[model samples]
Target: MPSITLIVNGASKSLEAWDPDMPLLYALRNDLGLHAAKFGCGLAQCGACTVLLDDMPVRSCSIRIADAAGRRVVTAEGLGSPEKPHAVQAAFIAEQAAQCGYCTNGMVMTAVALLRAVPRPSRDEAKQALAGNLCRCGSHERVLRAVQRAADSERA
Candidate 1:
């Protein structure tokens, strides 16, 4: 097994290599003990395993650890802290966007990237941006509001 170095949450993490094809989610969860990204569909269809790879949201469950090697990875935990949450995290909390919370991590991660790209995105834009993220709990409305709130909060 070889060691793969990854910049996770702005920190360099060395992963004890298992398989080159293994999903990045496994290493992040099992090795780093970061469980924010869930394995909802093994496939990349569900946004549950979404994480920021170099400032863009990618499906962790589908992305191989090798592909993520030497890349900048940011998980939900890396987004912010309890005392000073990221604008998106704070907005999600304020808007009560999470239902079961299973999809919250992905939602937050996606919104974080979106807000960075389009700080003042319209409601429809927000909806389209998060179209890939599936929140079976039917929290779409709140999620959109949260995105808007995050944009507002960030600009404040």
Candidate 2:
């Protein structure tokens, strides 16, 4: 096993990974105990395993642990807490954007990236940013509203 160092959620962690090619999702869930990134489609087609790698939304299921070395990885667990949630998270709650809640992690993470890149995105841009993420429960409208609400809050 080789030791890999990662900066996750603003914290530095050294983890033992037997395989360098092991998906980052495994290390995050099994070793680091971060469950926000789920395994939806191991192929990375679904965005359930989304997380922010250096402020960019990435599919944790397809990325190798070795590749994530020294990068800033932010999972949903790191995004916010009950006391002070991230703007996107607070918006999701305010907009009631989740149904089954399986895809909310991806949606929120992706939204965070988009908002960071574009402080105020148009409706279409918000839709395009979330195109990769799938919500089986069909809460697309609410999700859009949540993104907009987050953007609005940021401007306020």
Task: Name the best candidate (by TM-score).
Answer: 2
* lDDT per residue as tens, model 2, 43-97: 9988999999999999999999999999999999998998999999999999999
Range of the 10 consecutive residues with the lowest summed lDDT in candidate 2: 13-22
TM agreement with the true structure for every prediction: 0.98, 0.99
Off by over 4 Å in 1: none
Model 2 TM-score on a 0 to 1 scale: 0.99
For each candidate, the alpha-carbon lDDT, in order, equals 0.93, 0.96
TM-score of 1: 0.98
Report the C-alpha lDDT of model 1 over 1-156, residue by residue, as the tens digit.
889999999999998886888899999999999999999999898899999999999999999999999999999999889998998999999999999999999999999999889989999889998999898899999999999999988888
Task: Record all residue pairs in model 2 with backbone atoms less than 3 Å apart, i.e. clashing.
Answer: none
RMSD of every candidate to native, in Å, equals 0.7, 0.6
Error of 2 at 108 (Å): 0.2
- With a 3 Å backbone cut-off (N, CA, C), the pairs that clash in candidate 1 are none
